[model samples]
Target: MKVMNCPLNGPRNISEFAWGGEVKPMPDPAGVGDKEWAAWLFLEANEAGVVREWWCHVPTSYWFIAERNNITDEIIKTYPATEVFNTRVEFAAKAGAGEKK
Candidate 1:
């Protein structure tokens, strides 16, 4: 059986995890146009070498990062997202947005 080491839950069955996507710098949602936003949301680099990606532990709903080689399909390492992302970005609500009439 395949195994994956989750940062929060330790080693577990690969079935217990879900592949989120490649870890990339998020563009400013409010500043980008429809095309740019769409690309960011749907597109991927699909690189061949070792790439960092986001993964989730389904049972615990815990998300973390994994570095794996696409060609070899080998997981090089895994770690908590906090190791790469230390600061949180807050998006301010627009004026008169989502208010009842």
Candidate 2:
């Protein structure tokens, strides 16, 4: 079973989460007009390889997390939903990886 840790909600089953698609190019609300906003909200780029994504924690109503390179079943950098602003992605420090909880 795959597991993920939401910064806001803490560790939880990955199945409980929902993929909101690649998290990139957050449209500028002040700069872009309504038309652009509409597209940004409704449309998705859907790029491949090393992409940042927004994952929703349904069971826990926490901030969305921005994961990187989310292809296949496993996604990297499952961080707090609020820490989305962190430009640098720190891969999960799992056991054997010298990461102590």
Which residue pairs in candidate 2 collide? 7-80, 23-52
Candidate 2 on 1-101: residue-level lDDT in tens?
A: 77787777677887888877666666654467789878888887767666667788888656575656646645677676455575644444435775565
lDDT of 1 by residue, 1-101 (tens): 88989989999999999999999998886787889888988899998999999999999999999999999989899999999999898887978999999
- Candidate 2 stretches with Cα past 4 Å from truth are 86-101
| True lDDT of residue 6, candidate 2 | 79
Model 2's TM-score against the true structure: 0.63
**Candidate 2: lDDT of 32?**
70
Give candidate 1's whole-model lDDT.
0.93
Best model number under lDDT: 1
Worst 10-residue lDDT window, candidate 2: 86-95
TM-score of 1: 0.91
For model 1, the stretches where C-alpha displacement exceeds 4 angstroms are none
